[model samples]
Target: MISAASEVFSHAGKHSQDEIALILQKHLKVDSAGHLSNERRISPTRNQWKYETFSPVWGAPEGLNSKFAPPIDDLKSIRGVRGIPHQSLRSVAQWINSKIIPRCHMEWIVSSGALWIVQLDLEWEETDQGKDPADATMVAEGLRPISTASKIFKAFTPGDRTSWPKLKNLEDFDFGTTRSGPRLYFATAEQLQQALATSGPLLETEIDELTAGRAVLRTDLDRTDSGILNLPRTDTVDGRLAVAWLRDTLPLLSERFGSLSGLAVILHAFLPARAAAWAYFDPGTPIAYVDALWGLPDGLQVLPHDSFQVDIRRGRVISQKIRFKPRFLCEAPDGTWRYTEVLRLKGRSQVLSHEEAIEIGLRTASIAEKLGQDAQIMWFVGIPNAYGVDANLPWYRAREKAQQAPRSARRYRPVPVSKQDDLATLPQGDVMIRLDPEAPLIRDDAFLDEVIRIAQARKLPVELQGSLLSHTYYRLSNGGVPVVLAEPYSKYFRTRGRRVFGKLVRDRVPVGIKAGGEHVSEARLASDDALPGLFAKLVEEGQELLQSSDKDSQVEELSDLLEVVRGLAFQAGAEWEKVNQAADRKRETRGGFQERRVLLETSLPKPQADAQLDPREIKLHEFLRVEETGSFASVPIAALVSKQGYASANFELDGQPLVLTLRLSGSRIELRLEEEPSDETNQGDLFSAA
Candidate 1:
């Protein structure tokens, strides 16, 4: 619905939220007799339904029950039946905004049934998301729903922390053999002090009685063991995301953090997936409204469940039910509704820990394995949008410090569109932009990283094709075969081919080409140098590498050797199977070098005539300084000198016997054959005695 709306509005030129609201009303709401009136829905361009079968549970009056019943006569009388689709509406509005709005100067939120545009052209503000919505001007004026105008239902904002969804049933967790990992948390000093100040005396005393660093966390539920003892986990999502977004970041932070003064206090919290699902979605009378409001990614929905079963022995959960179950039931890989867990950590001191995160990752991986799908971490509908790195903030600065080079670090120049032909002319490889032209995303970075990772893993040669500033294109190829940049092949390196997406995500950042964006991942590189010679050199190096004690080193080097040989063979017009067959035939007849036998010397009778000499031998010796001192079967002295330059002869120096190698010092002076070529390694045997 949002996509079709965006296409329609964008094509029509400049539009206002008010205009969108009208169009939405026509499309979203049914007519008096429950019929769609939106023309766009039926248009060939969209071809989508504007309305769905009305449900009786929406408290439809008797007059509106039957299919033939008169269209809703009084839109006002049914006004009281409407309420919270809060998050879903926000999600849809955000989607439309992303797809249509180019300028981010204004922020729009759906409230009081009207699109409230908040001007944010100036600077970032300290947003209090939990503030009461009744204070908003639009809500007080009774904007859209008749109930709000008549003061029947209080308008609530989607993320109002106070209005979080309630899960009533609590089941005991049977953590058979599973022990809960460390309970991670995050909070700033101010938030911690505020919580303490608001705590009741008994609860306060309980917290006070705990050891110096411990605290009692109690839920507002009528159950035993609700107050679990936990130490203040002084970690923040800002800290986690800032200091450990990538695996390499932790190593950089662990030992060599240079200056602390540059640190900007980061303000952000992480609610683990289990807890966040509820805050991002609301289950209301009208179910479709939830989808539009949350704009959740496809193949997923939210539900909540118990983290533990009824049996808890000591501290170890001994049963399969010991795992944390979110109250929100999301659609798993197998199309089953399963409880998905999430946690939220906020502020400076309290944050989710690295170990707990690993635990969560493992749990999800196990779930994915059971479902016969790639292991993935599922997220709540709109949660991804809520968390983002603001470069103008301290976290961004920390990010720069953590990285070996900042994201903006220059690597190569961008090939202009005029150089579109240049992409085709690249030495040898496909052309793909390093990343999107706009903001660079971690997921994209991960995607490219995976490219390199797979190539290295497979020992395939990969070249960073070229770059447009920070955006670098990559080409992964082997035997002149480029990667297909699609599924089966595209997902070769990813642990999970799927992704955890944000509400507005289109299949989660769409992992393929953009329209009109030309992409190539393989190329048969052209070179002026002798590729066969290079291949030979690489083979030698690889053989040397094989001499190493480490089998892994040999394997990697051999992979490199194979890549070079493939290119060389292809360039030289050689077939792999034929080469292999030739090798097998030779090995069978002449035998291989399996036995460590040393060839101390090899000898053959010298040929007495040129006719007895092999052409291969002459070609081999053609590279030497020749002094034809002895008569070559009665050749003229002048002619022999002119042709041979110099010749060699056997002689005795003192008691030692030796052949006076063709030394042109005194006999004759001439240049050596410098451009001769030979692939065969032995020519001395070829020349001697035929």
Candidate 2:
């Protein structure tokens, strides 16, 4: 499996995705596949050791202890999880490391094949390579000693903050002068304190042109005048999104818990992973890593680069990456402060084997000591630990169990490229659905037609998401688990393909549109019964209509769009008339979209060609929910922005015809293609003319 994956990846680096994928399919075979548990995964860290009885041992290939393999399935039964019985040793390690649950359910992605007793380390400082268990510490002093062990790890570089261009106030923020859509503002310390004193603390909005269509993240969160709410590092889009979360979360939390500690606890309860991400900046480290740092705090500061060395298990830590320090310094109830190494434990593991994480944490503490900081070491977990520390605390501030919203795990079905180069277009909801006269695939959508009927009756648009845009996959089901065989997909293949079809099958003539992305999963569309997904589908369909030049289709699509709008309004707890009146009031200021207007200028990033991006256009933090994913990390920023429902309007700039395309991938005005550089007359300048 590794060889096949390696070959496919290597080929993918140089060739068009479709061609490379074809080459891979000719040579490769499927092993296993399913949803990744990485959404909530955390890199293991240090402090003290907590032990539990180990579960019954499971067998796997050499050097990989079955006790510490990659995780298995999270869903009850994924569709087609198994292709072959065993995978690579690497997969096994990842499975164990991820701490996937219900060991009895270990039934997918046999990531490794090599067989041997996995050796483990007792404890030792560390090395650039694997740790030998014999040289490591004694496990409680009674356990069997490990002779040897092998490890595989991954690392990442911290985002560069240089392009997070400093803007002192909201007034200076303008992603695009003409395209700036929604924005949020920060609350002053005085305003926050004042709000806190009121019966119901309320975060207010400044009400400016930027507030046009954006929702306010009004929260009741408050702190003293001297205390600052340490915001997570975010570019424009992510900052707005963070505010959106605060708007929704703060109010509910305000009514639930009366104390700051309660807020901290519930914050962890509601969104544990996000809360963890926030902890890096939170001066108090309130909810996450509670008790890791205790005391009258000095302030929060990030450690300079080159402070810690990276080893194999440490993954690939970039030398310049900033590491926040004083991570352990905190004041206890007695008002005295302490610095401690914090060991993080996963809640899912009944028997925790995180000696490596602990070692790393201790190593980090020692590094801090060398820096001349007086700090100690401790341990923390997703929940209170085996030692019962903070167990009695009001961590769960909810009056009753909060039914966390089901995570959005959208199901995908393969959609084939109907015509490899379909030029014939037919009207479908304003956007022309293209097909080829001499294509290999046959069209049959009786099943889909019925599905659409039911969807329209329910006032929902059929959702459509492109497949892994950069790679194409052949998916099949085995024992209710989804299995995938993937190869490269070209940038052209992704953009040209549209719509979707039923699942893939052997010798199938063809399917629907060729949706592409870096993901290996099939393109996804909500079933008839899926309402939430339909809302987005409707909005997408509406965008397609707006993109169309067909007047009749545009009118019809507009009606369909209005209907979707009404459905959205109902879902958002607003009446149709109220929405209509609000629209009317807005039109009184910014005129409605009557003429097909072309936006010519913006302060947002404009890339001449796909590359590192003019720093102005590069956003380090997520702006849209889509940016939150690493799936399209390598996809060109243009493609990402193109997904935003904006039309590539052609206009004249400085006496030259130029295309001013809106970068819609981010939630708001993010980037633009200043000029189509492909033209014969000049080099494409993203913003300025030749």
Candidate 3:
């Protein structure tokens, strides 16, 4: 009924809240006193009525009961009874606001063919979640539900201290052998200080908006014996200790990050045992690179971990490599965790399966998609479950650091290709196997098996056209001949082939002159007189790198360009240290180009000119004079030579040795040929005199 009212009067000022309530009351058969009228009842023949019926059928005479049944007024009244729908939620919310009860979890029921308010509780009843933070009191008085971890936190914190709000729920608060991980909470500086009154061995790390999360801290409070000692304990690491660490570390971090306002103090309940994973994602690509280790991710700073590449778009594991496993972190018998040598498993046993890695990649990709930026995610693979500890939007470092130069063409482990004769015996149809062409494909039985499974599930012929990114599709013909069809193969082949050749050329230059430092060096470039020319070449390469669409070419070109810049810096008698300092000063004031902001045109008031001038009357300086005979510059070449720091230079004019000398004539310098009597000069000494 409220939906009907909204649809009837959607425009602003067309109807007031009172008008809507009155309309609802009339339709729902409510009295002026807000009590439901005694004109509603469940139909006696409700069993015979259609179980599921639309609005139109509900209003019909016989639709409420059996078809042959006589019509009843109360039956029709049921159709007018009101309840919340998508469109009516807004109207109901407005009505709820006017109620004397400020906060409630309400229930509405259709009774005697009229809608009736059956229940109204002052607090959320859990039948369904009410509004987030149902009332202001929830925030002002800390009335919100406290998870087990948070309750433990409150016990340690002072009663008069600030309340540490729970950022998220601790999925499991009991420290059990099967526990996956701890719950995370957030606190302010005051709350953290209160919790830090009692502290012990704790792990500390700094965090800001741009950081990629930190390791979970393990403290004495997280010990299993704490529960027996009647002390507050958490299944995960003690949040109090984590908060204390943040309080002490925050000031130090502020020096580097420049501010504490943006810092979010997070406390994680420590989950013991098992392994951890971290993933890096780029918005431009459909892939996420993941690294996993046998121990806590805290060791990621120093230890080598297993790497896997996942195709986020298709949730497929594109490539994976298992590295040597020397040790892993696990729960010690004393309820603390430490690293131990990998005695149980020899070689590199996979920390996470292909499925687990793909799931992490997909989740990371979803976060990046929603945020519209790149992201890094960290997770813990614990007993029977994987916990996502943190997600972060990594700081933008495109201009802050130089990209690693592309070294060599990517080498892929060759996969067995089907021969034409083998293809001729296969089914004939179309099958799509989402694959990354550049990904290593050797010994991946899962990939090939999956393809075959998909084909068999689709019941396609043996000869089928397998499709993927820029690939050659094949199908068997009736005559047992294999027919091949490439969908835009040339496009990818030409581009990739050209990039390989380009990289070879780009790599060759830097490697050849890199040795002996003689071919290109500060000393060589100092007197070589080609610094400006090399600088110009750097500028050209920079422009090409920026404008080109090929990513491989850009990397190669940028590396070569940076080499030239280093040489130019050396020739200028300035080390990279000075250059970096100057760059920092300029960047601090002028800013970098990462914003991609373009200045189209500025709107400013036109300046008032004192006078106007005409081009015809203005006398221009005669830099050069030409009367269809020859040209003569007002400035002497000898002056230019001296200004250019050259005393004398040898040049070839019309294939003749011309030695030009810089001589002082009055206040100006003039260029004069060395006194040489030769008739080959055409005009002899006259030419030299002129």
Could you say which candidate leads in lDDT?
3
User: How do the residues 422-471 of candidate 2 rate in per-residue lDDT, one tens digit apiece?
Assistant: 21221233121111111111111332233333333433222211111100
lDDT of 2 at 113: 35
Q: For model 3, how does the per-residue alpha-carbon lDDT over 1-690 read when each residue is reduced to its tens digit? A: 668666766753465664433222434433211211111111222122112112222211121222333333322332344432212222333344344332333444454445444445442223322222111111111211233333223222112232221222121122224322334344443344444554422212222111113224321222222221111222123334445555566565456446544333444433433556767666767577776776555443223356677877567886665654545444443424454555322325677778778867776676567657775555665422223322211111111111221111112211223432332343344432222221122112343344444444653322221211101121122112222221112333212112131111233565674552323322233366656656655655655565558889889878877887777787778899999899999999999887544343446547883432322322112222212212222333323322222233445556666655443332234556654433432432443466
What is the RMSD of candidate 2?
35.1
Candidate 1 lDDT over 179-232, as tens digits, reads 221121222223333333464343223222221112212111122232211111
Clash count list over all predictions: 65, 69, 14
At residue 509, candidate 3 shows an lDDT of: 63
Instruction: Output the TM-score of candidate 1.
Output: 0.19
Q: Which residue runs of candidate 1 sit more than 4 Å off their true CA positions?
A: 1-177, 181-522, 527-530, 533-570, 574-690
